[model samples]
Every structure is written in C-alpha cells, then in structure tokens.
Target: MTNFEKLLDEQLSTLCFKPNEIVEAAVVEVDRHKVLVDVGLHTTGELKITEFMVPPSVGDYIQVVVDELDDGEGNLKISHNEVMVKQQLDDVQSLVENKTTVDAKVVEIRKAGLIVNVGYLTGFMPKRQASIEYVEDFTSFLNQVFKVKILSHDQIHENLIVSHKQYLIDEIGGEIARLEAPVEVGGVYEGKVTGIAPFGLFVDIGSHSTVLLHITDINWDLTKAVIEDFKFGDILSLRAKSVVTSDNGSQRICMSLKHMDMSPWEKAKDDFVIGERFKATIYKIEEETGNLIVSINGIPGVVENKDVSWTRMTNSNLNNVFKRGQEIDVVVKGFENKMGFESIVLSHKGCQSNPWESINEKFKVGQVLDTVVTSVSEKMLFVKVEGDVEAIVHVREVDWINPFEAIKSISSGDNVRVKLMEIDSSERKVSASICRTTEDPYKGIVAGTKVLAKVESIRVNSVHLSVLRKGKKLEATLPARYVNTVSRWLPSGEIEVGCELNLEVSMIMSGILYLKPDNSERAQSSFGTGDNPFAEAIKAALKF
Candidate 1:
C-alpha cells in the first residue's frame, strides 16, 4: 500500500475512545451520508453526518467523538444514536435538578421506566411517577410526541427519566376524580381495552383508573371466539357492574357488557314464543351429555341425542354442517339460566309435541255402520265396530215384532248396520242403535193409555197387556191395582190364562210400565171388582 493509504488505516482505528476524548482531523469532504475526517491519529477517523447536530460543508471545521475504533480492513463501527442519546440524557439531568418540564419523545419501553427524548436528550420515566391517573397504553407513546416532566437521571449509565402523564395529571386529576366518584351500581361508562390476560382484560374507563374485565363480561359471541380475535389498545364501551374496595381502601372496579345490558334470556323471552322456530348456531359439544349446545339467535340450547345411532350419524354427517360462525335453524323450547344471563333457559324439543294429537277426527255420533256382535243379552246387544271400541243397542231399541224374533234374525256374526247413538269422550265409549237410528219411538209415548189386554199369565185377575198383538209379547204392562183385585179372588196359579181384558197404563216408572184393568165384566169372575177390578170381583163371584 502507498504511504498515505497506510496511514489512513491506522487513523481509522480508535474511533471509540474514552469519555471526553478529543480528536482533530481535516475535513477532507462532507456529504449527507458521512464526513471524512483526518483525526491525525494513526491515520484518520470518519463520522457520519447523522452524528452531527448540523451537517458540515467541505473544508469546514468539524468535531467528532472518538466513540469507537476498528482496523481499516473493515470500516469503523460507530453509533450516533447512542452519542446523541447520552447528550440528551445530560440535558434532562440538568432539568431534573432544577425541576423543570420540557416536550419529549418516548424512545424505549422497559419494565421500570420509559426512556424519553427530552430536549433531544434521554431520560427515564418510572411507571408510578408517570401520572397520578394511570396511563393505560404506555407503549403507544414510543416515538410519540408528548410533553414531559423531568423526573430523575443516572450519571453512570447516562439514563434520563421523564413522565408525560405527570404533567397532564396535575392539570386533569380533579376533573377525572369528580367523574369517577359518582359511579353507582348499573351505571355505564366508556372505556378502552388496554391489556389482556387469561382472566380478563384491563380497561381505562375515564376514571383515571383501570378496571379489570373478566372473560365472562365479554359478549357471548366474542367470549366463545378465540382470545386472539381482540388485541390490546382496542377501545370499548364498558358497563359498570360493581365497585369493591380492598382492605387497604383501594377501590377495585368491575365492568361488564352483559350484566348492565339486556340478558340473552330476557331477550329470548321478548323475541320468541313457544313453538316458534328460529335459526341457530352450534357452539360446542357438551362434555357430559354430548349434546350440541346451539345458539338460537344468540340464545343457547341443547339438542340431546335421542339415540346412539343419532349421535353417530350426526358425527360424520355433520362434520361440515356446524362450526364456529355457522348458522342453523331451531325451535325455542323454553328458558334457562346460562353464563351471565341468569334467566336464560332454552329448549329445542318442546316444539315437536302439539295438542292436536289427542283429538280423534275419524269418529262422530249418529252414523250407521256394520258392527261385530260382541255379546247377546235379553235386553241389549253389545257390539264392536272400530278396533276394540264396544257399543250397546238395547232390545227395546230394536224395530222387531218381538225380542225373540229380533234375536233370531240378528245373529252374533250378522253384519248389522247400526247408528252411533251417542259418544262420550270422557267415558271413551259409544252408544249405538239398530232400530232407533233416526229417532226414539218410546220417547213420545204418554203414561196414560187404554189398551186391549191379553192374559199372558194367570195371576188372579191381573194380566199382562199388549197394544195390538196378544202372544207376540214385544212389550207388556203390569197393573198396579191388579194386586188388590186378585187379593180375595182365585190364587195366582188357578187364574185362567189367555183371557181377554181391558187395561190402562196408569203410570210408567223408570223403564217399568204399570197397568190397571178398565172393565167390570170380570166382577163375575173369582177376581174382585170395584173402581178397581179386584175390589168387587170376589163379592160377585161368592154370590154366584
């Protein structure tokens, strides 16, 4: 190497020197990037233009700190950022000693204090000393412009401490204190999300204090979402739920979005009704019941698996059917308590069952149909037509010459068309009719009636009477007065049968008919006769 170049290599060394180390060099040239200087050491040292307060022109006098050194095999390594930081720290130290304030820029964030640029010098601002009111987002001030109070400085490390909030706190603490003091239960306030933790978030609610936000306080939609969906420095409107004081008298504020607002249960009650259908989203598979906890318009409900096949079928079939943010349809079953919504109960199955199931629509009264004769008795026919249902048609209800003839013609297996006479849902039975499907004939019959009677039985002067037929015996009546007429006459077995007579139906009680004889011709007989036949008949018979 040439002599000048050889000397230049040695001069480039010792760029970093001790404190207060001074060096001189010729300003060979100056540029925006750097200035070439012949420090006249072993060779010459160089300084970047950024290191200088003012850029130097060519051939101008320039002074540079001998901050570091390196052999010319590589360029000298030096930092103007540190040198400028040291000078700024010295300036802030003087201000701290005098208790002065100056505008500054936050340079670095650390656990203990903020390194700030005060008057283009460095300073340290401790967290507590930063403000009387808490500063929620201190990191946002990094490289941000602000006015700061000079707090303290360290000479050895050349650290300068400053606080922007301290100056502002002195100006605004009273107003913020007034605003914070009157907060009551259920009172709401605006806040910003400043910090996030496993338990909750920390929010600044304009109270000069930061309040904790429990995870449960977040909206249901955001609660179930991953924690990463939100970030620090987000602003939110928080509702105050409680304010508790520590044993030391430090007030701890609790906030929520759900408690101060309408609960999901309350909202569901107002928005939905029983049997109403809605769309829903499946939140998760429950660990205990393995049911799907679905959200019906944000209300949660369980879809319990009715069977094992159903549970398994849904697994593969619904692999893509439901997921976070996926929408679905559901019916509101009922209400239940859940999460912060203490009244939020829900159901997805109650809508399936309806009141229409119990009403029988196919059957009605007064209808004729074929029926199976189930039982036969002297007075009635019991039959079943539809399934196991049984109905009875009385023999008196048959339109036949006599019950015997009706029985002979109507066998047990005969398909007889009958009318559904009556139905009682409470009794779960039907009454039918084979003869009186249209109207009941005996319903209009009067109690008093005179008719020709036949002596079907020889019971003294008493005899069974028929309206027209004598031996057919469709219906018969017994005389209430006949007992007296036969009292003194012949014995019941000695009385003649097949005798002609006159009878009146005196009165009918219940289903039994009572009859009285109208003729006095029987007075010659052994039977007595009077206004009642039996009273006089025995006297006349004794005279004969």
Candidate 2:
C-alpha cells in the first residue's frame, strides 16, 4: 500500500501483550528458582516456583495472570499464586451466589464456632450452625471433615461463612427412615452424651432422630439423679425403651441407661406387705396432677389424694403440703394403677389412728359436744368434732323454727354445740342435732290456748301458720288430721298467703300448733289418747 501503512504494520507486529490479563501458560522448562512457561509469546514468560502450591512438571499447563509486559529480558512477568487466588475468589463467589455445597475441614475451634478450610480460604461455622443437634463440645469435631453450604462471604477480605447444619439438612434431610434405619426399640445400643438437661440427658444413638434418657428412667431410685453427675462426651450403653412417632412423622426415641440391667419392677412385687407401715421418700410432685411419686423401700409407689388423709384432702392441696424429698409415714395398701402409676399403692393417713375408734365411748346419744361446721349443704351440716371426728346434722334437726334458714346461717368453720343423736362406732357415723342442745321453742305453750293465726305457707297435707301469741310471733303447723275441719283438704296450690284463720290451738306439740274449728267439740276436748271423737277420728285416720 502506502509508505505510512507499511510503517504501522511493523510496530503492531512487534508488541507482545497487555499487563494483568489472565492467560493460559504451558511449562516448557523448570528450574530451582523459576518455572519457564510459554504463553504463545516471542520470549517465554517466567514464574517463581515458590508461587505454586504444587510444583509443576515439564509440559504442565496452568492459568496465570500477566504481572508485567516485560521483565527486561523480553519475557513476560506472570504469577501463579495471584491467579490461583483470583480463581478461588471466583469459585467462592459462585458458591455464595448459588448457595452450593463444598467439602470443608475443621482447622480451628473457637468458642463461638469453628474455623474451617473450604476451597483455598478459611470460613467460620457458628456453633449453632455446626450441626443438626446441639454442639457443646467442639473438640470432637476438630480436624473432622464434612460438607458445608456457604452462608456469606467477603472476597475483598477473604472471609467466608458456612453452615454445617444447612449441609446436613440438604444432605440428611432429617428423614430418619430414608436416610438411615433407626435402632430397634427395646434393643441395646451405644450412645454418646450430647447434652445434659436437668430432667434428662440428650444422647446420640447414631440415628437421625433424637434419643433421650429421662431422669425418671435413669434409675429405680430417682433421688440420686442430677445433670452434674454426668459429663458431656461420656459414652453410655443405653437400652432403647420406646420409639414414638410424632405428629410431624418424626421418630422420638426414649432410652434408659438403667434398663441395661434387670428392672426392679419384677422384684418389687414380692416385697410388699399389704398392711405394713413404711417411711416413704417423696421424689416427684407432679404440678399438674399433684400426684406424688414416692420411693418406698427403694421401690416406686404412689400416694393419691384419697390416701393422703381420711378427711379427703385434694390432690391440688398435696402440692402445698408436700415437697420432693419429704418423708411421710404410709402403709402398703395394695397394688393398682388407678392413678396411672403401676406400682404399690400407699396410704399416708393409714398409719395414723382411726378417729372413728372409741367414738361411741367419747360421746353417747343425747350428749352435747362442741363442734365446728366444716360445710353446709341443703339437707346436711357437716361438722368436725374436736378429735378430727366428723359428725353430720340433718337439716330437720338444725332449727325447730326454720331449718332452711339455719343452713344458710351456719357457715364453714363456725363453732356450734351439737347434741349427738346416734353414735355408731361400727358405721363411723355421728348423727347430731343443733336445736336439741337447747330447749324447745314451743315449751310451756298450752294445748288448749286460743290464738289468732294466719296462713303463711301451705304444704301438700298441712297448712303452716305464724301464730302471734301475747305479742311474740311463733311458727306453727296445722296437723294434717285436723286440716279437714276448715280446709276440707285444701289443695295447697289453691291456698293463699296471709289467709286469716279463726281457730283455737288444739295442741302445740313438737313445735307445730294443731289447728281445728273453734266450734268443733273436738277443739274443746282434751287432745290426747282418750274416748274423744277427735282422738277416735285420728285413730281411724291412722288405721286408714
């Protein structure tokens, strides 16, 4: 072409390459100081052999970056270490971006986590993310190699973040049956202690699921178990007890270290004497059920609320009265699992003297005793005697005037005197009366006294009245035998309140005023067992 075009072509052909550009180089010759690599240049580029993690042989190819276009000898300056670092950074970036997995080796153990070597850089794996299970001892994992997923990374600072838990999730997936077959329940297996809780020990049984050695299942005598007794990393021979499938379909394993031996359950059955007394050590007081799990003669037993006291103390109150490790006197009652405990049944109050004993000698019928009202029901008053004896006062015996009102008036814990009506030691019952201790309200009232009465309330066969005699109002009831003289058997529903009655009191017996027509001859006659038409009619009515 032209003269200038010919000059430009000669200069362009003489130029070698740009600096910092990555280029693939092949080793042509190796020396002690440097490696001679040809990068398709006129003069071969040189690299320090020390820059390589592994020394290359002749004709080996490696990727390198151009450090300088010229090294004063017309050879290009290149670095294998620098390009290798850059390539690793690119790989770490890809791992971080794609969230991929890579094999890692634990290099150092830190209090917070683990320092691991992944690819060409070191990354931190936090203690919580180091495993699917809790990691209390990191020394077990030192120098251990496992796969991990990149959590975060800083290429500028050469810092990498990884998680062993994430790798386990993606790898193991926690599918116990799919990943590995779980151990058979009731079979013995070797387990390692991973954690220690106050109530139990968390064990690693080589299954994908969890295995726990509960405190209650640790030993027959539960008073000796504490988390401090065991150390982390202690390997134990545990027998699998139960395997429960959770709602999420994962298996939860229950193992016991004590089950490796013959359980005391077999030997305990022959040791119980049905009525013998024993000092029991309380172990666990269940807060929800208030059931006390006790150890008696080194065997587990249960004391229900019913057996706590003859007074029927509730299980809820057992929590308030008893605590773990407290000793109580009890008797071997029986063997039953009524309260969800399959052990000897014990009664705490059975060892004490029965309050019902000698009850007849302490108080006889018609004897007045100072009592405390324990409870008031509609028809009965439950009272407690001085020596923890229970006595009941029927509603009819509460008051001669009004018993319904007396039930409301007598509250719990009220002190009152009661006359014992019946004291039967065999039945363990004390029948009492409140009004019997005092004089009858109808005392000294004559049977033939005439009174102005008013109907207060009617019953099925009698009309109850309030008699105002000499300015004092007194309760009275018309005898059903004499009600027909004025009422002709008045159906109680048709009777009205405040209905005035012009009648003479034929009799006042047992706090009831027997009423009759003032004009009837029977009203004027003696109301007793005599040859009167009224008494004869009463006999005829009774016979009917």
Candidate 3:
C-alpha cells in the first residue's frame, strides 16, 4: 500500500467511526485513486478518489465525511466528493428558503446550464438563471465569480439549480428598500447602456434599474443618429421622467437625456427678454398658418408671415427674404403660452435709406419731364420718376391732359414726365392733380351753381347724380339719399360693396360734406309717408 493508505489504516486502526459522520483529517499522501487521510483519531482513515471534489493528482489536501465503518479493526472510509455534494445541496436549499448569498466560479458549460463551483460544492446555473438578459456566449464567463442564490435542489435525483441574477437582485433590493421613498420626477442619474433598439435605448442605473432612453430623449441634434451610433457599453447621464411597476412584477423606468440638464426654454429666458431683438433665421415653415418656425440656438418660436409687413412684393418675393438660409433682425414681440415667443414684426417698406428720402429732390409739382412708362394698367400708369430710379408716380398723379384717356394711349415703353403734386411720407402715397395739365370743367362751376347731373343711382328717397370728374371717379354720395331718407335706406335697399352713385353736396360738416342726390325728374313726396318710391319704381319698371 502507499504511505497515504498506510496512514489511513493506522489512523482508523483504533477508532470505530460510522458512515455519514463528518470528521476532520490531517494532510497525508494523496493519489488519483485514494487519499491517506489521518482523520485525527487513534488510526488514519481511507478516502476514495471518487470522493474528492475533483480528480486530485497529488500534494492536494482535502476533508471528507466517513461513508462507512469497518467490521474487524473498525476503520472508516470517507467520501470527499459526496460530502461536498451534500453540503452544496443543503446550502442551496437554505438559499431557496432564506435567499442566502454564495460566491461561485464558472467551471464548465453543459447543454442547458452552467456548472458552477461554489466554495463548498458544485451547483448548476441554468441558462434561465444566468441573467435577465439573453446569454449568447457561455464560455466568456469561465472562472468568473458571482454571488449566487440556490434556487432548487432534488435529493432523489441529486440535482441542484442556482440563480446569480436573483441573488444580486435580492441583495440590491434590500439596499434599494433602505433608500429614500419615491424617485423625484425629474431626477437625473448616471447609467450604463444595457441594450439598443431601433426606437430607443435601455440604460441600467443600479436600483433605477433598466430605464428607457427613447430616441426622442436624446439631444435634439443627435436623435437621428443615436440609435446606430451609440455602442452597447456607452455610459450616459439621463433624467428619470417616470417609474411604474408592471403587472408581471417588473419595474419600468422612463428616462430622458434631452432634459437631463437645463430645459431649453428655461435657458432661453435669460437670453431673450420681452422686447430684445436678435438676428434670426427661419428653421422650419408651417403650412397651416403660413408662419415660419424659427429657432435661436435650441429655443423655438414662430414668426408669422401675416405679422410681418411686406409691401411692393409678392408672396414668392417675401419667401426670398425669409428663406431657410436668410437671416433678419427681429424684435422679441411677446411670449404666448400656446404660441411660444412672438418676435419682431418684420417690415421691408421704404424708410430713411430709400432713394426717395429727399422731399425737395429736383422735380417740381408742374414740371412735366420725359420718362418711360415702366408699368401701365387699366386704372394706373407707373412711370419712372425723373433721374431718380427709386421714385415713381401713378397715372392719376401724372399731370396729363386726360389721365384716363392718356393712360390708355401710354404703353410700357412710352415716356412721360409726371408732375409731382403731394408727397406725404406718413401715408406712403403720392397725390398729383393730373387734370391741371388737362382742362378742368369742375373749376368753372361756382360753389352754389345748379349744374346738370346725370342720375346714376337711386336710393330710398333720392338719386345719385354724376358729373364728369377729373379722375375715373365720378362724384357720388355714400348713402346716396335725402338726409330724411337715411334711416329708411338702412333697412330697405341691399346696397352692394361695388355700385355706381351720384350726388350733390347738400352741406359740408367738419370738412366731411353731406350730400343729397339731384332727382329733378321726380316729384317730391312726404318723408316715410309715401309708398317706398324706389321699391315702387323698381316694381313698376319690372311689372312682374
């Protein structure tokens, strides 16, 4: 026999030990088949090779429990492997009941489970017990130690199942329970990226657990690229928006990176006040309101096209001024809760810088000079004013013999000198007496003269009369009725927006002259007492 076997025989020669009794053994000679263990008794004990935790070569020390007692000399034989297996089974059962923690190393991988070697024993860590996440590679965890909880054990089948994920969770859960009550709504946390999906990212923050950082939660600038660009191991700071537990006992956490720092609106408050102006560019256009959605830095607001005054231009022309890359000075109008901040009303109208700034710039009121008719329409003729390219005049304002007839004869290439009559910058329009160049028939009529007038329109109790005027406008009354017939016309006649009228000034009050039509052909009747004459005349004429 080997020296170890001799030592085991000598140690057990006097003592009578029973099987299933745990006993301490002193180091002795060890081998592949058996170990000569001095069981600290009168005689040494013999430990079988299969009883070792693993296949021992030599010089390795181990403890074992006696499996059986001898008949004659009463020597004990111990099983080291069986003792370890039983200890692990008891430990795992204790963990399942009390959730105790055990440190274990990954030894080998089998079909559906990991062979874990706890300090005292070996336990099975099935795929389901590995992690909450899916495990793609099992070999990567070889020799790695983890705090594990024994989940289940089968004494009859000699099987053990353990979970490392649950062990961490139970211990961490205790720590989390000791932490403060509820998480603040906008509280921020530092976390690691656990996974990535097309729609969002998942982050792990200790007890904050797997918080979701949606694609929208990323910084506005990086939202589009965050999905494919972010790595699995990236660490990011995020804000917790909400937390809720699911029906299945899983925790859900909503997170945001965009608001992890200061909100853009709050930061914007310091940069832009109520009336401060800034050079802003249009970032986006809203088709519904015809408004430009503009952004300063990351702060967003709108500039309505209607709010901006653009004259002497078309919509397409206005589009050029506020296009994507175009910038303009805008005053911060005001903040609207529903509409955000309103900014400076933009205007492209002529001001001091315009070439028509000088009131006394060469051209006189009656100085008829030659100029090309750049634009001619049915009612107006736009002429290039003097040598000044910026100034122009309408046909009515151009001293012409007969502006109406004269404008018809003029074309785009025709040349004419327009006599400037009035220049009022406040109204932004010019007035000229074109008839001064033509014959003024109205000038010959005295202030109180009874002139022949053609009846142009009929009202409740009077008629609108017209005499040839200087312009295309034939003089007429607004209500076109007798002073007494004002109230009657308000209800009866459906006066249209565009209609012809003629009248004589009955009286002028406050420079606003009152007028009555000259209906010399009709006989006079009592006010409101006679049948509605206009209606009666219409019915008589229709005879329907």
Candidate 4:
C-alpha cells in the first residue's frame, strides 16, 4: 500500500457512520437502479432509486439515512424512505399537540375505518369519525382528499388516528355562534326546510342553524294538515315563537308559520254583523257533540244542534242535515271570546223569514188548507203549511174517538187537509185540527134525537162513551149527574165497558155532547106533553 492510500483509509474510518443515523448528502451520480451520494467521507453512499419520491438529479443535495456502514460491496448503504418517514413523524406530532387540521388523501378503505396518507405518514380514521352523516359505503371516500384533525399520534407505537367529523364540527361552530346572536323570540325570518319528521319540519334558518316548525303551528286546521304538503328545500316565512335552552346548554328554536298572518277571529266582529245573513260552507261536524263547524268568508263559526233548524225534529240531528263542503245560508247571532279563543254563534234557521210574522193576516180560524205531513209523533202530527210554516195537529184534535189511532194512521209525506184553530206568535206555535175540516157530528144532532152509545171508559166523575154518527165514531162525556140520573139504565152504579145505553142529546156546546137517558116519558108524564117535553127540559137545562 502507498503512504497516501494508508492515510485515506484512516481518514474514512474516522467518519464513523452509524446505522439509522440521518445525514445530508450531495448526489454525485444518478443511475437506473441506485443513486450515488457523497456524505463528506472518503467512501460514497448508495441509495435505492425507489426510495426517492421524485428521482434526484446528479449533483443535487438530498437527505438520507445510514442503513449500514458497509453492505459487503465496498459501499455505505443509505435509505431515502426512512428519512422521509422520520420527517413526517415530527410534523404529525406537532399537529396533534397543537390540535391543528391538515389535508389527507384516502388510500384504502377498511371495514372498521379508512387508511389515508397525510403527507408521508399513514393515518387511520375510524368509521364513526368519517363524516357528519352516517357513512354506509367507505369506498366512496377512496381517492378523495379531506381536511382532518389529528385525534392521536404515537410514533413509537405507530398509532396515528385522525377524524373528519371533528373538522366539520369545528367549521360549523363558527356559523352557529353567528346565528345564535341575532335570533330572538317573536322575530320573523325567511328560512328553508331541510328535513321532515312525523312531528314537525326541520328548517334551516340563516347561519346554518336548524329550527323546528311543529305540525300544530303550521296551519289553523290540524286534521287537514299533512306532511306531504311540504317538501325538503321549501322556502317559508316563519316567526320565531320561542327560544328554549336545554339541559345540555344547547338552544332549541321553535318557529311557526301560522303566525305570519292575522287570526280570523281577530276581525270577526268587523267582518260579520248580527242578524246579517251570509252563505257559509260546512267544514266539519263534531261527531260527539253534533255541532257544525262552518266557514263564513274563511272565518270559522259554530252552529249548535238547537240552532240548526226551527223544527224540533230537524234539530235533533244537525250532522245528517249538514255535510262537509256543503254551502248553506246562515245568520250571525253573536260572538264570544273565551280563554284566548273566539267563537262565533250562527244560526241556519234564522237566515230565512220568520214563519210566525203576519200569521193572523195570512191564516184565520176555521181556515181549511191542504198540507203535507212532515213528521208524526205519539201526541201530535207535524204538518207543513204555507211557506215553510209548520203547524201541529194535537192528538185530541186529530180524531173525535181514538186520537192515538188517528196519529198512527198519518205518516210523513202524506197529504191531508187541516183547519187552523189557534195561532200563537210569541211561542211560534200554530195549532191545527184535522177533523175540524169536516162537519162536527155534535153540531148536527138535535136536542131531542135519541141514540145508542157504548160505555168505553169510566173516570172519577165522568163516563166516556163512543157513539156512531154518520159512520164516524165520536167520543162523548157523560157527567156523573147524568150517570146518576140514568143509574137504572146501567147494570150497576159504576159504568161498565161495552154496555149499551139509550142516550138523548140534552145539550151540545163547544163540540162536547151532554147526554141523558131518554127522559121523554118522565118529562111527558110530569109536564103533561106540552110542546115536546124533552125540548122544554133541554131548553130549561141550557138556560135558553
């Protein structure tokens, strides 16, 4: 060996390059397989070409790490990949300690999380921390770049975890703060609907904050309000009803769409006048109460069952008379407000002209007119007279003998002639007699006529008898005095049913026949047959 060569060997040994030590080297030669670099030592270090992210040009400075002092090829081996990895570790540690965000590229998708490359270091993002919304398919994130926050970083354990959801939350926090400051109760704002739930609609008021518009506050009618009426991204004008703070210190916003307009009841008095008639649409009928809820000029009003009609038979069921969407004439009676709610009382029957008005001028006693039977009850028959006027035919006035059988013989929609007997305007009642349309049988009977009658019923002081006159059965009351005078004519002192009696008409007044036994023999024998003794006795009894 030469003396200068021996000195070079000793100088190279003094450099003392150790394994895993980082050093800056100058590239001397770039080759296909390896890049030769000068580390300021007598011997040159060679780095694999694959380790250089961007292939280094000759004579360029590059960082390298010592892999071995000698690789048995008379050269020192170095690695560029190791130097890049060490630099990334230092950068990631700084980000974790400072809680900073950096951009990461998704490299691979795993069932539990995503593997991303942040600079030269690989990081793992758990499935739960992927995004603000639930991620079902992680592969959609492949090759996508997102801003991420470092959740943990441990270079020794090689644990580097990052979260994309944390980054989104931090970004939205600034917008939330800006929105919370200006939003106040009772303030109106324009917003867009973001989500729809069964209970309400979620609206995104400006500044990325979402508020709830409950179903009840959406419209005046809750039954007709439906979720399908609204859709996502619908713009609406809303009024903030309340701002509530939850137990978690989070603010909840309640908004309303109905408050955007004035209430109908607030202007009801000005819109409707008492006794004024208007056409109204029936919107709903309460099944339980049978009250009709109608809309008059878009204002809701109520018509109770009693106010539905003038007749008692029609008022019993207002639900069946009025149906949804049916338009009918109604008169506004009055308005009442209770418990922050207003109710308008209306009547459908009052909208028409009163039937009792000028009743005396239109009808007179003993006036016979054809009428249709509207309804029949046990005690009376309801008949419709002129112009929606209804008159009642009482059971007593229905027939002279069997009032119950007469009522049963008549039915609704049957045509019959009735005579007006009484008119009461204050009570709005008209009394009519069906039998009075014909001649009264008692009026035709003379005082001396003798007829046969059957005892029907015996009362405390009177005995009722049924008599046949002109093929019509007539009821006659025989007073106790008359019954006592004819006691020998009866089988016992008490009258019995179906017992025949010989009766003479003693007096007749007010459609009632007063009867006594044929006393012509006694009167003739006592008065000596002068000018018809029965007639004389009747004239004396009636105070002629």
lDDT of 1 by residue, 1-544 (tens): 9999888777665444654454445677777787777655434556667666556676765455555465556544434445455556556546777657687777788888777766546567787666433456677768876777666666776666666655654343312223636456577787666555665776667676777877656765433634465665566676677777778866777787656556554666787786677766666654555466666655455566431111122242233234555665555555654433343234343434322233246567767777677656566666765543467777866664444457656656567778887766555556787875534434534655655555566444345555553323335656445645443353342335665445556675544446664444433342433555544555555566
lDDT per residue as tens, model 3, 235-301: 7877776767778866566777766554554556666776666766666555556676665554555
Q: Which residue ranges in model 3 land beyond 4 Å of their true spot?
A: 1-14, 24-29, 33-50, 53-62, 70-77, 85-103, 107-113, 124-135, 142-209, 214-216, 223-237, 240-251, 261-544
Instruction: State in Å the error of residue 340, model 4.
Output: 5.9
Cα TM-score per model? 0.35, 0.39, 0.34, 0.37
| 19 Cα displacement, candidate 4 (Å) | 99
Instruction: Give lDDT tens digits, candidate 4, residues 1-544.
Output: 9999999899878678889988888989988998888998536887778776579998898888898878897778888888898888877767888879898889899888999988767889998778754346777799999999999986676768998876865664411234545567778888766556676787667645677787756764545557789875677898877777778867777787876765645667787889899988887777666677887776668888667766443432344346789998998999865422345789987876676677778888878989888777688777887655678888888876566777888877899999998877777677899988876666568786777778888888988887888777776778888776665333234457887677777776655567876765443233212455554554356343
Among all windows of 10 consecutive residues in model 3, the one with the lowest summed lDDT is 520-529
Q: Relative to the true structure, how large is the alpha-carbon lDDT of every model?
A: 0.57, 0.72, 0.56, 0.74
Candidates' RMSD to native: 36.2, 22.1, 27.4, 28.6
Over 4 Å off, model 2 = 1-185, 246-248, 263-265, 334-342, 353-544
lDDT measured at residue 157 in model 1 versus the true structure, 0 to 100: 67
Instruction: Please report, as a residue range, the 10-residue window in candidate 4 with the lowest summed lDDT.
Output: 521-530
Clash number for model 2?
A: 0
* Worst lDDT 10-window in candidate 2: 486-495
